[model samples]
Target chain A: MIKKSLGIALFTACFLFALCVGPALSADSVKIGILGPFSGSLAFNASEMKKGMLLALEEVNDAGGLFGRQVELVYGDTECKPDKGVGAVKKLLTRDEVLVVGGGYCSSVNIAASQIADMEKCPVVVAIAISPTITNRGLEYVFRTSPNSPMFLNGINQWLEKVKQAKTVAFFMENSDYGRDGEKIWSELSKKIKAKELAHLYFEIGDTDFTTQISKLKNLNPDVTFNIASTTEAALIQKQAKELNFVTQWIGVGGQFTEAYFKMTGPISQYAMGSSLEPTLNMKSPETAAFVEAYRTAYPDSRPGIFSSQGYDNLKVILDAVQRAGEPTGDLQQDREKIKDALEKTDMKLTQGRITFEDDGQVHSVVPSVVQVQLENCEPELRIIYPEDRATADYQAPQPWRERECQ
Target chain B: MDSLFLQQVVNGLIIGSVYSLIAIGLTMIFGVMRISNFAHGDYAMVGAYVAVFVMMWLPGPLGWVNALLAAAVIVAVAGVVSELLIFRPLLDRRTDIDMIMVSIGLFILLENLAQFFFEARPRMLADPFGGNTVDLGLVSTSQLRLFCLAFSCVAIAGLQVFLNRSKTGIAIRATSQNSRAARLMGIDINRIYTLTFGLGSAMAGIGGVLYGTLFAVYPTMGAIPTLKAFVVTILGGMGNIRGAIFGGFILGVAETLGGSYLAMEYKNAIGFVIIILVLLIRPQGLFGQREGV
Candidate 1:
């Protein structure tokens, strides 16, 4: 009886959800699905991504919407799960009947949603997720505005080669697809540089205690440690490493540079090198300055992360395609095809840099900068120290940490 | 290698002590009420938030002490509220499963509520303890971790004393053993349940504050600890406090040693594996008194 009741309750909840979010077809508006996580651990970044997309929507409408019709954004919250993302994409494609889609925050979620979009022939503009495999999936509808791991790997290798000091190395890989790619790249690169790969360690995404891992690492005593964890995990690991007096020349492929990393680790995060998409200190392009200013003006209380910037750029790319598509003609199928065709030939300059994608809808060789966590003007910031033209600061190796004073 | 071994051991012990507090509370609730109290971790989360406020409002040398007390008291109050509002209503149904279901519901509700209020971003307390280390021969132990270990031991010992000596604690124990007999002896079972819940929640509260100081305070921060607590409970038996402590340490040491010896990827998974081995060897738990069998 309890099982029966539970089934009934679940059915009712689903029915209610469908009723509440009933597909409203607007004949005078062009509908585009915006996919992102609205809940879960990643919900915070997803919300930021949403804010960026919302800003883009208003901007597009302000300067006259696509095909002389107001663009209506249909948001699909995937909650950062692969299965849930596919479900969101299904709802967007079939129920909402969206002509085009924008936004894919988490790499795993984005890849799942984009895979579905490919099957449905709906164009998807990828924002934040930077796993190279997502593009390598051979999906025609999926196009990433952000740089991938292979691109960041080049920057990382370049920086490491320039230093020429790291002969023995260790890697702390998160047991996820993103980390798997990093492990592959870093492991292969170790052979090229003839560095001793002491240990290729792994940890769960949300594991708080890194003491045990660091204890094992301390014993191995590698000269350099390559970290491939998320922003929080990276910060926590670094903080614990400092506490344990297990200091090394820290290196990260991507996903470590953040305001939270500095705030959480404080001065201890100093001199750690990592690859980043965000131009933390020096804005090479005028557009980056304007984007930052506009973001700050819009969200006074909060600071936008790299994900938010990616969201904004992705939307702009999608809008560029919509304008290039020229006319909607009130037919959803034809309008979608037109957007897809236009997106294929998308060549434009944006805040990050000149944005373009190959036939596989992936941006390769975007030239990410090797940045060091450094103190500038009494604030901790990522100072780009590689790619000489983009370098705002010089590279600094991890300094021997001072003994922590008692309270 | 010797230095690393000692460091890992110290790390395991420090982290294990915190796990013991959380597990003891969970075990106490299950022992008396037979309710799993899956939302116990969220209770810890609530306490951590309370600590954050307390620290901010009252800043000085004894600020952290006051923050800890405030966290425990506030979380204890929250615990009583959960009992009065949810558990008390479901007691008439005569089903332990109903109470467990309510706990799961409470967990989801509390997590979402915390997420709504706190957001998903992690918040950290200003380091009152700072990042100071006290070298113990071969291994350097952080002052903050030492504080967490010492506080957890004191709290657990105090709870043990309360159970052995206090009249109310005896009544609670009686209720756990024979509810009908306790009821006939004029001891209110409902009151006992409420006290047990509040006490258990307060223990979790202490764990939460320490967690916030050492690691971070976030909405979903309680998740992994809760899973580990469950594993500890299994090793210590369902509702035994002494067993919870032993089990927590055992699991912690096992995880640390396993991670070091085998693979770091198996760090979290190793504890569960140990629990499985223990279950296969002796089902009554290491400290569990064989009741019927």
Candidate 2:
């Protein structure tokens, strides 16, 4: 009877081990969380980010997945709200239990989500949030895949000095965190460039009319106008400026140089210049060409915009991190650390260019391209005219005022 | 400073004209119904969208005109439908606050619906006048600005004539003064309320079209103008028509001039301060009548 009882106990123990270790010993699955504003005012940009991410995921999966395990994406829609973003991060971490999280479009949303990541010790890869405060907070776990505001503003300043030859400047900005931060940077840079700020107009988020502001601009007659607003506001301001016949040189930040702006303002967009991290259709790079072809094939309805390219690049960075980390073990903490370490040491050549992260987890190598609107045969075109080596189109300098030329 | 001051004033006037049209509609609705239509701004947004669609379909001369007509018709129909479905039912229950709340709900609903359809991108309504600058020697002006000012004046005159000569207009005025008395005198209270709302919405729609032509149209385009309209209506006496026009111009000019001379960033704050001062000084408006009839 003792022998029989001992044999039964051994069988029971073996049965339990098989039940626990069966799935673990099989192929592993790596889950990555994507968070962004998918159902709010910035939904279009978010949607672009999603498209880019999905395309990269498809490419990665086709190439035998990340570290020979299936890479899965879990999406959380923050709707461009801070509270919603915080909630989304919590859900992705606790419920989804994703190893790596990515995608934040707005600066405020990124800040809130980054705080959550810091607390949970989960590494977050920001796709396109450019607020300087994101990095200034000194969060260890937060890594931005896109360039921060300072780098972008510094590029703008350099372009203004070397290309536009701008001296007197006026600033028009929206009164939000994004706008205020950008305004501060631009203001400081303006002084550095020896440009006098004639007027700095701050508008609310939903303001439609700018006649008053434009008229004030006309009166000041600044040599150049810096529109530090979103693409929508920039379009409206440009249209109104055209109406007032205020023919001054115009420059805008990242959000301002897009197909939507060109379509809205048309010919009036001429002589307007802006900077972007991604290349447009005019770049004609082999990597960009391949992306455009794949994007067109995948998303027939949507045009491959600059933001989409940035989003796709972000996904590639994440996949590279996962592969470099080696095969995912069932252990969550161990896998997360490996991925984070891999990201910190990323020096991969990507479609955008060679991407490497600094000590603060910010992308070190970023090429900010300056583009200007030109009237090519009565049609407005966005021509990359700065950084002559990378430019695909010719530069047309702004026609100087009669007095300035005479002087 | 002189040239800058002059330029700012000119800018203010152009902006002021737009405020006048929006404020007039809000003032009319409040004066007649004694209910603040919070959804009035959404009506403006709808108008802008309608105008944009029209311009896209019919691009050329008279595009602006077609857009104006389309905005008026669409907003009028929407106003009538709201009265029939939402406002009239609430009125029967004697729930004024509920109606106000309903208007707010409608505002959010319409804005979201607009997002679903328009996709948050700002669309430009073709400007017939284009961007021709009329150099007025000292202060420059756009032909579009001149057109906007002229349009506002004509609209005000036409509305005045309709209120004075038209039979339905007199009934609306009578209803605003005394709803029960008008009911007793055989005036259909429901009809008057519907007509007032429809007219007010039509005015708001026209304002949206004009504003879109001058600026650009987006889902949240109506919010700032809507808030300004509320301030203008309250400052001009809740139900005063002429007072709304005057208040709109005053607020617009003040904001423009303040931004130019004082601080460009504080332009909105300047308008808010004016409202507070007016409320403190004369509880009524600059042109508001005393409550005693």
Best by DockQ: 1
Clashes of 1: 0
Stretches of model 2 off by over 4 angstroms after superposition: A1-41, A57-99, A161-165, A281-284, A299-302, A319-338, A400-407, B94-96
Per-residue CA lDDT of model 2 for A246-365, tens digit only, reads 778777776666666777777767777777765554446677778888988998976677778888988888888888888878677788888888889988665566789888888868
The alpha-carbon lDDT assigned to residue B109 of candidate 2 equals: 70
TM-score of 1: 0.93
Chain B, per-candidate TM-score: 0.95, 0.95
TM-scores, one per candidate: 0.93, 0.87
lDDT of 2 by residue, B203-273 (tens): 99999888877777777777777898988887788899988888888888788777766887777888788
For model 1, residues B110-149, the per-residue Cα lDDT tens digits are 8877886777777777666667667666786678889888
The DockQ for candidate 1, computed on C-alphas, is 0.44
Per-prediction DockQ scores?
A: 0.44, 0.23
**Candidate 2: which pairs clash?**
none
True contacts kept of 1: 0.57
Model 1 stretches with alpha carbons more than 4 Å out: A1-29, A67-72, A280-282, A326-331, A403-407, B59-61
Residue A49 lDDT in candidate 1: 74
Recovered fraction of real interface contacts per model:
0.57, 0.51
lDDT of 1 by residue, A366-398 (tens): 567788878765466777888888788887655
